[model samples]
Target: MGPGPKVKCPPRLAPCGLRLVQVRFPTGLTSEEYVKQEAWRFARLERCPFHPEGGCGLARHGTYARVSPPGCLIARWWCPTARTSISLLPDFMCSRLTGTLAEVEAVVAAADAAPTREVASEVLRPDVELPGALRWLRRRTRLVHAGLAAAIGLLPGLLARCEPTITSVRSALGAEVALVRLRAELVPHLAALPPPLGFGPRPAQRRSSLTALQQESGTDPPSGTR
Candidate 1:
């Protein structure tokens, strides 16, 4: 009888590249030394069980592999043209069994959760307030106020014809400088100012007294008194 068609084991038989690899050192080696040695070895290969399809290629084609202790390997191959290819990959194969699983899970989770350009753009939405616009508006308003103050300062000599241009120039200069000083001075003055008139308990006491007087007279309090 003809030999039956050769059965190909599923590519998934290869270890997942996403899992962490922990190599235990002999009693003589320190943990730090063991880590350095393994890191160097993995770096030389440029292909670890944690990234089996080999970096970008694996990601693009949705292929992955996982390797476990004592050289247990599993992998998944995907066909880009097939819509169901994603399902063929080992889904959520817990890498928790490995000694370094926590570190591996953390790395993988962070990579998976990283924000894309689209996500960043959405977060910094166009509707958000802009510091630049506020700064520009504030500058323009200050310029307008300075211009108005300068014009007002020149109003006193509008009817005078002798050296009107010089007078206007002087007035404008003085007004602008005065406005700058006033802004500086007014801030401190306002900081020192007490609260507005009638803001204290005196107003409430007066209102109560007025109401009592009105009640004895059996008439509404005068609007002026109120």
Candidate 2:
């Protein structure tokens, strides 16, 4: 849905470049109509992250429309050297997830609070199926746990107490905004780092799971936007 040579990039925006300049969007605006009016306002960009020639070539290439969930427009910045446009995405949504960050957080909380998917569903996601919600939660936990561990230091076997993830997850449970705060601190920074880390078997006994997932998904790593 952004720029680059990949077939998935949208057809609009002149179809060029791989690099983009990202700008943060504030919350409150919702729906396609709202997005259309606001997307253009974030069009301002600067030096390209992918260009080797050292030029602030990011320009107001155009806007792409999105429907579903929040339904908002995604504005793109064109980078000639990268040969594509970069869509400015909101912090509230993951680049790949179909649901909003709140939705994702809801599911994660549900999963953590309940013993079974059915139980969690009954408590929160009564409208959705278990398989879908559980899978999404697993993926997010995988990324967040591993990514955070990678971004910061964690203790090794026997001394692995106080890992950043444990604090973050506990924080999430206590506060509604905790998950969002964690995502803000982690996702964007981790996105640039491909090949997620495998933290190892157990923070207290062996290699953490973060290290394990990295090894498993190493062949094809996340683009970070996910």
Q: Per-candidate TM vs. native? A: 0.14, 0.55
Instruction: List the candidate 2 regions with Cα displacement exceeding 4 Å.
Output: 1-40, 52-57, 121-133, 151-175, 183-190, 193-226
Residue 135, model 2: lDDT of 45
Candidate 2 on 1-226: residue-level lDDT in tens?
A: 2333322223443434343334444343443434566644555545444543344344566665543344455666666544655655565544444445555555555565578756765566456566544444555555455544554442233223335453455443455534344444554553442112221221232345444333333211123321
RMSD to truth, every model: 35.2, 9.8
The numbered model that scores best in TM-score is 2
Predicted structure 2, TM vs. truth:
0.55
Give the range of the ten consecutive residues with the poorest summed lDDT in model 1: 193-202
Kindly list the per-residue Cα lDDT of model 1 for residues 1-226, writing each as its tens digit.
Answer: 1232233324664433332222111122222343334322222222322234432222212223233322222222222212111211111122212222222223322332446523322333335344432332222222323332333444345323322122333354464222222222233232122111000111223554445433332111111110
Model 1: CA > 4 A from native:
1-128, 157-226
| lDDT for predicted candidate 2 compared with the true structure | 0.46
